[model samples]
Target: MKETFEQLGKKGLIDILVVIDDSGSMTEEQKNLSTKMNSLLTSLKDTNWQIGIVTTTVQASDKCILTLVKSTDTDAEAKFAKAVQAGLSGSGNEEGIRQAVNGLKCSQSPWVRADSSVAVLIVSDEDNCSSRGADCPNSPGKTISYLTNYIEQTLAREIGKTAGIYGIFSPTVNSCKTAGNIGYQYEELMTYAAQKSGTTVSKIFGNICDADYSNTLNAISSNIALLLKNQFELSSAPDSGSLKLSVEGSVIPAANYKFSGKTITFNAGKEPANGKVLTAEYNVGAVPLFTKVTLKNTPAADTISVKVGSTVLAASAYTVSGNEITFKTQPASLAKIAVDYRVAAALKNAFQLEKTPIAGSLKVLVDGKAASGMTYDAAANQVVLNPAPLDGLAIELNYNYRTGPQLSYQVAIVQGAKNVKLYDGAKELSYT
Candidate 1:
């Protein structure tokens, strides 16, 4: 039982290498690196994992140096913890590509076990080596090509018949030529390398300290979990006496479904087989409270009364043939009018406000027509105008508010509001 548990645990282990750029420009990038590493380390600590670190710069004697830490042991973990605490300041003599590839290769030795899968996490500006020498070429394409080929060949030979790789590129160097030339070359090289090695490459820019980094790492972990799940499925045998079926329709028969090993079986109750097509109609739910309801299948000339709670708000009919519902007049109420007019803005923006406040008895006009019971709030920068006795009319805002370079606003017409044209000030932004 102990051996079996160990085997199960071993199958779930994820061996990862973290290759970071320690070049001159990477000094500023170190903050982001530290944050990302800490978050990743914290999240991955509970799992059976190992991490190796490598750095790249032009100052070190060795171009590719590996800082291996035995993750399974306490002493090694402490040592590695110290190294990571030292952060991304260590310098190296080469671009990170070679070192990262070599580090991953080192992890795949025969002693490491053939069943262990390897993944690489590259945090670099992607700058190649810039050692000033007559033999050193300015172009990084050749170096990149060699690294890509080497990684592909190594993974194919060592880890498994099928192996996966993942990479993350920092925004410090994205272009091929710049003040920091390594960034661009690094990106290009890694992109090609990832493609050749069947790896997933992600480019990170802006604030690396944000929750987005954690989210991205979580997504990668989820993907790794999926891969492990697939492996488990492949190792299991299919049950001989079971038939598995997948249904996509809304209606499903009431049956007992069982899964034994790799086979799924469905046992049905004793019910007479009716020749009629089994149908299930699901109401898409209350048309989103204050939002317009554009039915895919419109009703006929005979209108249908739509109610909110016990109050019969408005009755608008549509012509429905097959799966399409085209309504004549867009549905609108005092409470739901704002949702029908705001276009291009997110649903959450309905609550946004400008500086000045528009009081309770606010009014609206569309193309010189009076619209009643309109709601306006200048403090939140929001306005809702709807013509009374709803007849598919357009509403416009003619209020004074300060505009800034970064401030953005959107206006949207209700789903079925006909001949509606929304304008930003006098500029006619959109028509629906």
Candidate 2:
């Protein structure tokens, strides 16, 4: 069977909205964004880029950044320099993004081009206040989902894909707080923003408290450039030496294309013309740098680039098509390929799980009973667990007994000065 390539629509023209937090601590951060705004455009070549700015908090004057410059604009450098600024008085960041989207779309400024790809760049040092009426009361806060829905569905719905969210926020994972500047409950929303595309997909994450945004800007700019260039992943890995790429049935010139693991990136100005049929043929295991497998493309699917052992590879390390998985590099032949991923908490009960031939089988106990309701479909490579496991149950698989993510630190009872026992759940390895 031929490997089918899924081509995404060209995002050559993109409209970007930058939403920043404007509280007192943000004075310095906003200046970095304003002064370094032009640095982001360097990587976005051959792209119809329109830039705008907005604060995460809504202010008294409805301050939203207007379109600064298009890729084709003359003296675009000066225009961008003139329009981008990080204000220090925003107060409604939770619903601020929603407001900005509406405001930008309705503005008379020629910033948002018709039918263009969209990107929401959020920069903040504290957590967001998106409540969306979930448990929190007495405040007009929007839920992360509500904001994501608007960004993906309402704001850029016509683009046929979710707008890219590039964020430089306080670290929600293993958070690091510097001195008096801090946040309390924004990790969930920051995570939601990164995972808004419904995949554990990799997006930009920068420390909002950092003094230098040079690295963040570089990473974000590179990501945007790739998105705008319409880079596509090969359905499977091929030997770099034997690979043949065809566009419109004609083999493309070697100079026109380059290979980064499994993704064949075309140089700017050398992209395959539109309506062209892109295809590649490869030997599955030829000096492989990554592995490939098909997976279910559902919101519940653990369909993002996976971690093998201690390495957390980026999404670029995996080429996931409609329902298959491919890796950018191959692991050791003896090494087990396992990924610990997260699924949406709202998955349907008794739902069948896809991603066939998983590295391990399901070994979860529901309600204190060995889970017997779960069955695997070999043909479909899915798990049929009827009456989905109850919420809040930690369902983990022990495929090949590889060390997965550590849940937490547990205290062990000390029998003597040198005799302490460590345990994982009920399994004790040793005592010394």
Question: Which candidate tops lDDT?
Answer: 2
Per-model lDDT: 0.43, 0.57
Off by over 4 Å in 1: 6-10, 35-38, 41-47, 57-64, 74-81, 85-94, 106-113, 130-142, 157-165, 168-182, 189-213, 223-432
Candidate 1 lDDT over 91-166, as tens digits, reads 5344555565666555434222233445556555444554221123642422655445554565543222223344
Model 1, residue 244: what's the lDDT? Answer: 30
Clashes of each: 33, 23
| Residues 174-246 of candidate 2: C-alpha lDDT, one tens digit per residue | 4547512233334454455445444342346577767788777877676666456455555566765677777
The C-alpha stretches of model 2 lying farther than 4 A from their native spots are 1-11, 59-67, 78-83, 92-95, 107-110, 130-141, 156-162, 174-176, 179-190, 193-203, 229-432
Would you estimate the TM-scores of all the predictions? 0.39, 0.44
The positional error of residue 68 in candidate 1, measured at the CA in angstroms, is 2.8
Q: What lDDT is reached at residue 211 by model 2?
A: 78
